[model samples]
Target: MISFIWSPGNPLPAGTGGSENYTVGQVRELTRRGVPAQVVTVGLGTDDGRDDFVDIPFLSLPTLAAVGALDGTVVFVNEPHPVPTRRPAFLILHNPPPIREQHRAFAIEGTRDRALIATSRYAASLWSSYLDVDVSTINVVYPFAEPCFAAQARPDNRTGTTRVLFAGRLSPEKGIYTLLETLHIDVIEQDVALTFTATTAGADKPQGKIIERLLREHPAITVVTTRRTPASMAALMTEHDIVVMPSNSQYWHETFGIVSIEAQHSGCRVIASDDGGLPETDCGGVLLIAPDNAETLAWGIRAAIDSGPLSLSARRYAGMRFTVEQSVDTLLTVFAQPQPSPPATIIRQLEELILAPSVEAAHTVRVPTGTTA
Candidate 1:
C-alpha cells in the first residue's frame, strides 16, 4: 500500500492548481493498475475541499503523528513535516524553497533521510542546490494533463478576433498583473482585436481579492468562474484561441506551467514567460517572452495572433507528450528504486557558514552561482 500525505490543516483543493491535479491523477492511475493508494489528510474531516473529486479515495487521520505511523510507503506533498515513519518516506517538492532563513532551516531538517522528488528538472536543480544535496539524488516526476484535455476539439473555423484566456490562479506570481498592464497599453489596445478572459481561481486569498477586483474592473477582461474539473477546464481552453502564462521571474519562478500543456493539448496556442520551468512546458505551441514585462507579453500576444491557430501536426504531437500514464510510470520506477542518502551534515555546515548577523541580512543571503533562492 502507498499513501500520499496532505499537509495538516490544509484541505486538498478540487482542481485549482497543478499539485492538486497531479496528486489526484497519480492516485487514480495507481488505483486503475490495482495498486492500493489513497490521499491521507489530517484534521480536515469531511470539510476537505474534495467535493469535485468524489471518485478519488481519501482517508482522514486525527493528527500528523498518526499519518507518520501509517504502515505503508508515505509520500509527503509540498511541506516536509519532520516525523518518524515505519518505512522510508518521500517528500515531493512542489514549490521552490522558502526565501526566509527560518523556513529554509525547517525544510532542511524535514528533508533528512527522506527521498526527494521534484516536479520538473528545473525544480530539481533548484532544491538540490538549496539543500546542499547531489542533483542526481533528486528524481523528477513531471506533472501531466488529464485525458480530457487531449480529447477537447477545436472549432472548424477561426474567428477574426482572438480569444485569450488566463487560466491560472488570480495570483501576482502567475503574471495576471503583467497581462493586465499589457492590455492597458495604447498600442495593444488600438491595434489588437483581442478579447481577454480570466478565471476566479485563487481569488479567495487576501491578495487574490485585490487582483480579482482589478480583473473585474478591466474593460477588456471578462472574469469567469473557476472550473473545478479537468473536463470543464478542457472545454474552457478549447473555446479560447490563445492562453497566456506570464509567471513572475523576479521572486516566484514557475516550477512548471501545467496550464501551458493543457492549452496546447486543447489545440490553443500558448504565450508564456521564458524563465524557470515555463519553457519546459512546450508541447509545440508555446511562445516564450521576457517575464514580468508587459511590453514583451503584448508583443508575444501579437505574435501568436499573427501565427494563426495551432497546426494539426502540432496538436497531435501534444496529445502524445505529457500523459497521466507516462507520469505514473516514471513515479513507479522511482518508488521501486532505493532512496539516496542526502548529505545532511554538509547541509547543516553550509547553513552555519551562511548564517548572517541580522534578520535583514539573512533574507538577502542566497546560495552561490548556478543556484537560486
Candidate 2:
C-alpha cells in the first residue's frame, strides 16, 4: 500500500494558514481513498488518526526520517529530515532556504529526500538552481480553498470608496515594511480605510515596527495582529475590494499563492509580486507587482482598489484552478503507480525509473473545483 508521512506545522484545526490547509487537505483526501497516510506532528493535541490520515506525534522528526527510509513506499508532504526515510517519497518544496543559512547542507539533504513534488513550477526551478542540479521530474500541484471563501458574500467596504487590505507574515521577505514606507509617503489612506492583519508578538524584524507606525500614524487604518481564522479571512477579503501580497524573494515567492487564489475566489482583486509562483496559478487572478519595490506594490494595490470589483468569471477561474480536488488528483497519479526508484539512483541520473512501467494504465480522474480561504 502507498503510505505518506507529513510533518506538523502551525495553523491547523483552524483552517487558517496556507501550508496547514494544504497538508491537512492532502492527508484527508488520500486517507479517504484508503491510502495509509499519517502525519508526524510536533505540538501535542488530540490525535486525529482516523480514516485515511493519522496524526501521530511521538516519532521525533529526526528519528522518523530514519524509520521512514525503510518504508520504501511512503510519501512526504513536507521537508526532508536528518536521514532519508521511506524510499519513493515525495518532498513538497514550500520555498528555497533562507539566504546566508548556515545549514546549507541540511537543506540540500532535505531536498534529496523527495522524488521532488513542487507546489509551483517556480519552486522547482528555484530548487534546481539552488542545488545546481537538473532534477526535472519535480512537478507542480496547487492547493484548494479552505471552504471559507466558498461561502456567502460578506462585504465590509463601508463607504464604497474601496477597501484596501494587506495580510500575511510580518517578515522582511513579505515586504510589509516596504509597503508601509510607500503608504507613508503617498498618504493613500486619507480617504480609503486600509486594514492589515498578521501574526504579531515575537514577530521578526520589520513587522512589529511597521504595525506600530501604521497604527500610530493612521487612525483611519485598522491593524490586527493575532491568530487568523477562516471566518476572519473571509470577512476581510469579502469586505475589502483588493488583497495585496508583496513577497520579496524569488525563493520566498508564493508557491501557488493560496491566499491570492482564495481572495479572488471571494471576489477580491489580488495584487501580488510576480517574482514567485504567485504568477503560476493561471487563474487569471492577481495584478502582478514587481518584487520588493514599494512604488510598484503601491501602484498595484492602488490599481486593484480603483478598478471595479472582480467579475464573476474571475472568481470562478481562480476557484476552478486551485481547488483541493485538482491538487490531490495530480498527487494520486504518482501514488497509485509502482514504487518510485530511490532518490540516490535518480540523483545520479539513472534511467531505471525514467523508463516506462511494464503494466498498462487505463484510468484517469477529473477533480472538482471550488472557492476557499
Candidate 3:
C-alpha cells in the first residue's frame, strides 16, 4: 500500500489548486491500476473536503503519531512532519520555501532522512539552494491535466465578443489583483468587446474574500462559482476563448501553472506570465506576457483576440503532452528507486573539514600574481 500524507491542519481541497488535483489524480490512477493508495489527512476529521472526489479513498487521522505507524511508502505532500516512518519517505515540495527564518528552520529540520521531490526544474533549483542540497538529488514530477480536459471539444464557431476566464485562485499571488487593474484600463474595457470572468476558488480565505468583494464590484469582470471537479472546470474552459494566468512574481513565484496546460487542453488559448514554471507549461497555445504589469496583460489579451481560436492541430499537440499516465509512470519509477541521502548539515560539513588531512593547507588562499594583498 502507498499512502500520500496531506499536511497537518490542511484538508485536501477538491480541485482548488495544482497540489490538491495532483494528489487526487495520482491516487485515482494508482487505484485504477490495482495499486492500493489512499490520502491520509491529519487532524481534519469528517470534514476533509473530498466531497467532489467521493470515489477516492481517504483516511483521516486524529494525530501525527498515527501517521508514523502506517505500513507503506509514505509520500508527504508539501509539508514534511518530523515523524518516524516504518518505511522510507518522500516529501514533494509543492511551494517555494517560506520567507520567514523560523519556518525555514522548521522546513529544513523536517526534511531530514526523506527524499525530496519538486514539481518543476525551477522549483527543484529553488529548494536545492534553500535546503543546501545538490540539485541533482531532487526528482521532478510534472503535474498533469486529467483526460477529461483533453476530451472536451471546442466550439466550431466563435461569437462576436471574445470571452476570457481567470481559472486560478482569487488570491493576489495568482495575480487576480493585476487582472483587476488591467480591466480598469479604458482601452481594455471600452475598445474591446471582451467579457472577463473570475471564479471563487480561494474565496474562503480572508484575503480571498476581500478580493472576491472587489471582483464583484468591478464593472467589466463577472464573478462566478468555483468549479469543484475536473470535468466541470474543463467545461468552463470550453465555454471561453482565452484563459488568463497573471501569476504574481513579486513575492510569489508560481512553481508550475497547471491551469495553463489545462486551458490549452480544453482548446482555449492561454495568456500567462513568463516566469517560473509557467513558461514550461506551454504546449503551443500559450502567450507569454510580463508579470504584474497591467499594460502587458492588456496587450496579451488583445493579441489573443486578434490571433483567434487555437487550431485543431495545436490543441491536439497539447492533449498529447502532460498526460496522467506519463506522470504516474514517472512517479512509480521514483518510488521503486533508492532515495538519495539528505543534504549534509552545516555542523557535519564543519566536522568533515576539521577531520580532513592537511586542514590548514586546505584553507590556504593563493593570491594571483601582481594582484595585491
Candidate 4:
C-alpha cells in the first residue's frame, strides 16, 4: 500500500500549481498500476477545489501520532510536517525547504527514518547542499505534465498574428513585473498579439488591481485572470504560438517550471528565464532570457514570433520526455528501495534545518555557505 500526506483540510490537487498537479498525477498513476494508493488529509472536511483523481481519504495528521505502521506500507509526504509514520516513508520535497528552520524538523524524531526525493536534479543538488544530506540518498523525480496538456494541432502561421501567452501567477516573484514591462515593449513595437493568463490570484488585491488596469489600458493585450480546468488550459495553450516564463531567481529559484512543459506539450514554443530548473525544460525548444530582464524578454518574444510556431520534433520530444508514465515509473523504482536510517550527526544537522530561522540567518549563524543549517 502507498500513502501520500498533503496539506491539511485542502482537497487533493489543491490548485492548478505544479505540486498539486504532480500529487494528482502520482495518485492516479499509482492506482492505474493496481497499487492501493491513499491520501491522508491532515484536516477534516474537503475544500472547494477538486481534481479528477482516485480520491482515498485516510486518517488526519493530528490523529497519526498514536497510529501504528502496517507492514509493506509506504508513505510519501509532499509538505513539511513531522514524520507521520514509520512505514518506510519518503519525504518528497517539491520546493526548497525553509533554510534556517530545517534543524527543528530533525528534532521531530519522526523524520530521521524518511528518505528524500526532489523533483529535479537542480532541486536535489540545492536541497542536498542545504540539508547536509548525501546527494546519493536523494532521488530526482522529474514531474510530468498532465495528459490534458498533450500536443495539439496549431493554427496556420502563414498569415496569422503571433499570439504569446503567459500562464502563471501574477506575483513579483514569478517575474510578473518583468512580464508587464515586456508587454509594454511589445505593445509599443506592435510586433505580436499578447495574452496573459494569470493562473492564480495574486497575494494581494493591489497587484490584481494593477494588472486589471494594465489590461484595460493595453489595446493589444488580453488578460485571463480566472482559473481554468486542465482541459480548458490545454485548449487555451494551443491558441497561442509562444508561452513565457520569466521567473525571478532572486526571491525563489523556480524549482521546476511545470507550465513551461505544459506549454511545450501544447505545441507552444517557450520563452523562459534561465532560472533554477528552467534550463532543464529547454529540450532544444526554448528561447532563454535572463531573469528579471524585460529587454531580453521582449527580444526573445519578438524572436519567437519571427521564428514561427514550435517544430514537430520539439513537441514530440516534450511529449515523450515529460509523460506521467515515465515519471511514475522512476518514482516507483525509488519507492521500492529500502528506507535508510540517517546517522546521529546527520540527524543533528537536520534538526538545525528545522530550527534555523531563515536562509540568511542560517548563513550568518551556522553554515557559512548556507548549504547546511
Name model 4 segments beyond 4 Å from true.
Answer: 13-15, 48-76, 99-112, 155-159, 186-189, 192-197, 200-220, 225-228, 343-373
Steric overlap count per candidate: 0, 8, 0, 17
Worst 10 residues of 4 by lDDT: 45-54
| Top TM-score model | 3
lDDT of 4 by residue, 293-338 (tens): 9999888887887787777887877777778999989888887776
> Which residue pairs collide in model 3, if any?
none
Ranking by lDDT: 3, 1, 4, 2
Local accuracy of candidate 3 as per-residue lDDT tens digits, 260-343: 999999999999999988998999999999999999999999999889889889899999999899999999999998877665
- Evaluation by TM-score, superior candidate among 1 and 2: 1
Cα error of candidate 3 at position 260, Å: 0.7
lDDT of 1 by residue, 252-358 (tens): 99888889998999999999999988888999899999999999999999999889989889898998998999999999999998766656645677788788465
Candidate number with the higher TM-score (2 or 3)? 3
TM-score of each: 0.91, 0.75, 0.91, 0.80
Give candidate 2's total backbone clashes: 8
Candidate that beats the other on lDDT, 2 or 4, i.e. the better one: 4
TM-score of 1: 0.91
Candidate 4 lDDT at 57 equals 36
Top candidate, metric lDDT = 3
Model 2 C-alpha lDDT per residue in residues 127-244, reported as the tens digit of each score: 7787666756566676776566756475545574666666665566666666776675464645355554443422434655665565556544556554345555676678677778
- For each candidate, the alpha-carbon lDDT, in order, equals 0.88, 0.62, 0.89, 0.70
